[model samples]
Target: MSLLPHLHRLPSRVILASASPRKRELLSSLLSPLPALVKGINLEIIPSTFAENLSKDGKTAAAYARLTASAKGKEVFDRCCGEKDKAVLVISADTVVESPAGDVLEKPSNKQHATSMMQQLSGEWHAVHTGVCLMLQSSSGNMIETTFSTTTKVRFAQLSPEVIDAYTDTVEPYDKAGGYGIQTAGLGGSLVEEISGCYFNVVGFPIRSFVQALIELLDKVKDKDDS
Candidate 1:
């Protein structure tokens, strides 16, 4: 059955609080299964200004990511809700790579940083976590928020210094978390020896999980309307 009708019936002003092209592409593709879903959506790509400098000390990777995502979502939700007179749904996400030794690895600060990150990941299994937040506000001023996370286990093939240098030299490693992108063809994708979970999670968003969560949230909103 087509879900577009239901999607359209809900709060139509949906916002994606991210500037990452990969995420934007993933989300647009996620809704593309339903013809015209992309066209129907009032999606606004407003990047969040939240400082993601939250300390990772004593927090699990999932918790850290989830918190960061929630903060980002809340920042955008507040801003959008203030401007729009209708109900708004804001989606935000944050992805991070956790080294085998348990250190959280975010985007590299420099070329040397990228090289070091590659060295840490080479021949080792690491966890990639993507945290998501959904903030929905009804026109009546009611607000609902949910947050969840997905983790993928990825193992990198043993890499020589030359290989690391070759990868870091390209533009692939700087913008992406973990200093690599699993979706990047030939270069970044070649780093992973194997992955134990959703491949899309490593790419930055978990579409399956997001779909399920959105359905559940929509149902709740529908019930409120019917009541």
Candidate 2:
């Protein structure tokens, strides 16, 4: 009666095209009761040249997230289709924090960079945007990609220089976007004041939206097979 039993009967395998441990953990929750239903594939995270233009008009945080996720999915789909695995499903995602000043804070490179990012986020409200893409390879070897994005309004508490420096010394901020991990030490729930949207989105993945999308995708494939 579990979802995994049904998913196992599908025609293709589900592959997560990301190297992020956070993503791997989140996706694992989706493929539950079916051991190893999701496999992680390390795909390059570089966006295409076209993706850079997605925010040319300075769109909302949600728009930018969706666009980035779609781009990453397409990139991975192109690479996977070239192989013999014609009926594979690839999931890709990207997360970014948009500062009030309109700058996108990505993963920081070092302690100094992380400290600077934390300082900018201190005592302010910022937007967390996460874009998720689902790419499925058809029987005809055609790849179809669908994308969606989620936005969470996060408000951080005012941090003294000592607090920022203390948090930076921990490992929790280095591997996450905007140099902070919301689920753990990223100040989302513990130190953050408020959030306006999906809680999981700030943690890294939007669980509700992601599950709904997966179900819809599977239904489409089922209908096609029935025909």
Candidate 3:
């Protein structure tokens, strides 16, 4: 019985392997609602140093996302998993916007590029891919790794030129994929007509899936402890 409940309050600190503020915010929000007992476990923000220059020419959205996340997780784990007394869970993620024409949209170079991306997204559906990797060093000194990806379909609501230009002028689109960020709330909600998948995936991470994986990992750790 104690083992079952122990899954909820992980002793290991959660390490977020991303420099993106949005990812940091979203991952922190997920753990914020845990019981007060687990509050003592800190969330470590460690950005991955892996270069994201992978080629997306022939890869599916999921494959690309998974590759990027896996590399990032491995990079961070190598650095932090060396000499930790408690366990460590490293979470890494990468996102890309897939256009209707089967093209991948990364962050824009400038306002003009963002505006161009917005124009292509006008009144069309695009897929948002988020590759999430979780690697953990258990309390008993066991290392585990897993990776997955989530995709959300997003449709823009026929943006006029003025609207595209206006949104691009803001600093938000410059660092976001497909010239928009759904987590931006006000600005992104206006341009989006519909979304048909995980909302947080469009932001950077997937909440539901991550929680499920974490629970599974915690249960496994508990089992190992009991043995």
Each prediction's TM-score versus the true structure: 0.92, 0.78, 0.89
Q: What is the C-alpha lDDT profile of model 2 across 1-227, one tens digit per residue?
A: 23443455344566666667777777676565444555423323323333434553666766777777777767766765445876777787878898767678777878899899888889899989898988776565555557888788998888889888888787767778788877774353456878899888887888788877766776776566566
Report every candidate's CA lDDT: 0.86, 0.72, 0.81
User: Candidate 1 residues 41-81, lDDT tens each?
Assistant: 64679999999999988999889999999999988877766
For model 2, state the Cα shift of residue 210 in Å: 0.9
Candidate topping lDDT: 1
Write out the backbone clash pairs for model 1.
none
Question: Model 3, residue 220: displacement in angstroms?
Answer: 3.7
Residue-wise C-alpha lDDT for candidate 3, range 1-227, written one tens digit per residue? 12234444565577888889988887666666466655534678888999888888789877998999999988888887655635778889999998888788889999888888888889999999998898777777766677888899999999898888888888888778777888666897789999999998888888887777777777676677678
For TM-score, candidate 1 versus 3, the one ahead is 1
TM-score of 3: 0.89
Model 2, TM vs. native: 0.78
What is the alpha-carbon lDDT for the whole of candidate 3?
0.81
TM-score preference between candidates 2 and 3, better one: 3
